[model samples]
Target: MPPPSPSPSGRLQWADVPPPLRARLETTLGAPVTEAVTPSGGFGHQLAAALRLAGGRRVFVKAAPDDEPLTAANLHEAAALDALPPYAPAPDLLGVHRTAGWTAVVIAHLDGPDPDLSPASGDVEQTWALLDSLTAAPAPASYVAAVSAAPSAAGLLHGWKELRDDPPDDLAPAARSHLPRLAELEAAWPALATGDRVVHGDLRADNMVRDHDRGVTFVDWAHATTGPACVDAASLAPQLVLTGHAPADVARLLLDHPATAGSPDTTTAFLAALTGHWHRNARRPAPPGAPGLRDYQHRAAAAGLALLNHRLS
Candidate 1:
């Protein structure tokens, strides 16, 4: 069954119901459209609309702005949806429409709220259970290669160096100090060839939801790719803390994993670079010492670094 849908709010926009496309959608969906609006973020210019179609079917529509790569992902997502069964709660692909400059996928809305990511959240067991179910599915060769090719923090750091923008004085010193180490970490790409698991490259809390029994429904397959099971484990380990798992436990599990269980130095450098990358780009500033994703990233870096340093000693 579809998980709960997100709460609807605000007004519709041109992107949600452009004149050129509205007629086609109404005719095809066979429903009166009463409302539409852009959902939050997605790759490129993406918007999701909730519409009351004919026969009282409440359908969700995802539209991508006219572009090459965006069109591809929309089609790709539709295919992935088709391949996977109804087990893990993902948006159901209803239909695909391609225009001169745009591509859109109509899908059945999952009926649930976004999973809370607050510190009090304690749903790791649930999250991991869902992950297990997802991994149990067969992954194709192309899917694995595409996910492995997804943009990495190492690549972004290289771009940042090229741009030479002045980071905040407080941040610059640490970032500058870590630049070499980051490069070193980037060089030591661990072997991820042990498994053929389908992975969600970006499985943060916002992109996931929990059901009435705390069952998980991971959304946003743009980052879904075939890769090492450990990569997914490492990516999700940090999130456990935000969802109420003890950070220590999360770190231990990720560290103990065979794929990630390597030299302390390599692990430290990898974790540091990963968190540093996110902190540098994604996190918003807040009160000093306030706990949030940024703080957690810093701490993960420190812990990984400490493990590395100890091994070196």
Candidate 2:
């Protein structure tokens, strides 16, 4: 099946924007918006559009209501993009706007297609190169201190234990049978993700944009954080499978990465934790204002579990 699709619930059109916010955007670009287009790759669950100005400038804008949870995420994204290293390939932040109804971030437009993670695709290598660049420097001090201070993956990877305590009838036979062991294995995850490198906490094909000239530029820094360098590389393993690579191919990719080598147990634990986290979250009701998120979580859980089973075998 194709990847989960983007939702329209929280999306905003140019006409939906308040006049004051539109005026602010015009002022930032120093011209009037001539065209606005909605891109179709991310699960932003809020306002996201690409705008072209009369003066020929282009920009990407993302916004959310001030009272919504995504508002804080928008702010974090702005800070993260502003603080990224010179070598990191990401869009430049142009400005931010906060009015009574909306909080928005304006960034330079990146014209490109999403990377192809299909088996043996050159785009796979491009993604790897982007990850290499991202981890080359430590995360920004302020960004790390603000975002990493929250609970680590260890605290959030215990879905198996929770499910075991009150079993879900729909749990897959493999997962149901392995629940106890999965819980035990996942307990080691926190230590595995501890390191001084910055992680794109949510790395996936949709979050990557590949330009012929710029190579690969990673977008959506809302989930960026400071963690073990290996975590970012490891996180992409299951996605490789989801996008057409076999489990062995994914394993080989990991083995070849220096940062991921000599950490078989850690990799396994991290994958298991990821499976648990997605499995648990997939069964819950979609959060308010995010209509398609739960379905995406379910698909991601299946992919993660498939990779986890492969590693276990």
Strongest candidate by TM-score: 2
> What TM-score goes with each of the models?
0.68, 0.89
Question: Compared with the true structure, what per-residue lDDT tens digits does model 2 show for residues 131-213?
Answer: 77677667777657756544554567768888878889888887888888888778778767777777777888888788667
Q: What's the C-alpha lDDT at position 301 in model 2?
A: 81
Sequence-dependent TM-score of model 2:
0.89
RMSD of every candidate to native, in Å, equals 7.4, 4.5
Q: Please identify model 1 stretches exceeding 4 Å from their true place.
A: 1-17, 37-45, 85-89, 118-122, 136-168, 172-180, 190-195, 211-214, 242-246, 256-273, 280-313
**Could you say which candidate leads in lDDT?**
2
TM-score of predicted structure 1: 0.68
* Cα-lDDT of candidate 2: 0.77
Worst 10 residues of 2 by lDDT: 1-10
Tens digits of lDDT, candidate 1, 69-180: 6556666666666555556457667888766355678876655566765545556556666666666656765554444544432344221232135554544444555555
Model 1's alpha-carbon lDDT is: 0.54
